[model samples]
Target: MPTHFIKLKPSAVDEYKAIHAAVWPGVLAALERAHIVDYSINHYPPLQLLIATMKYVGDDYDADMKKVAEDPETQKWWAATDGMQESFATGATGSGKDIPWWTEVEEVFRFEGTS
Candidate 1:
């Protein structure tokens, strides 16, 4: 699982939510095909931050991401979304790679409740 944070433009919050509320079926299928599961996004209106969490059930992360990126529907989704986000403040990942958007946050701790 991974958690990421990105800032939304001050004015794009509502539109962003609206658009995601009914994400295109193709986009959902594309994510599934790329082995992304349990994907979710949340918003903090006060800070205008969008938080996303997802599990990648694949051995090759770069390959899975490349598969998602090359999907036509995902490309269209990005075209619609690329302008709604604030410019990257945290530029690189823990791997020292400069990613385009969404800074990955390190998880310090977690608790899975006993059943």
Candidate 2:
């Protein structure tokens, strides 16, 4: 299994919080079916930033992303909330990427005190 991490700047804290408060049911189901496990998002209030992590356990990551993208309900859900996001330079406008609202990062540590 490999872990992916990403970060995004929220258009507004309340707007971001509201959508996450009730993630759409269809999207949630798609996430599990696509082998996305242990997903989570953390926030930095002062910076209005969000960091997300998802674990994937498969050889073909692109296949999983395709499954997620192909779901009709997931598409609808994204359409409704797309405007609430603010993209960083790397984000594609109205085009889906590995992470919808965030940019990926290279992992530098696993356990804080392992060394």
- Best candidate per TM-score, number? 1
lDDT of each: 0.80, 0.68
User: Which tens-of-lDDT digit does each residue in 26-112 have in candidate 1?
Assistant: 989988987887899988889888899998898887788777778888888887886788655555332112465677799999887
Each candidate structure's TM-score, on Cα atoms with residue i matched to residue i, is 0.86, 0.75
Query: Candidate 2: which stretches are off by over 4 Å?
Result: 1-11, 95-101, 112-115
- Report the C-alpha lDDT of model 2 over 1-115, residue by residue, as the tens digit: 3433333345556776788899998899998888887788777666655667788875678888788888988888867755665556364564255544545667777864856
Tell me which residue pairs clash in candidate 2. Answer: none
lDDT of 2: 0.68
Give the Cα-based TM-score of candidate 2 against the true structure.
Answer: 0.75
Model 1, residue 1: C-alpha shift (Å): 0.8
RMSD of each: 3.6, 3.7
Instruction: Give per-residue lDDT, candidate 2, residue 55.
Output: 83
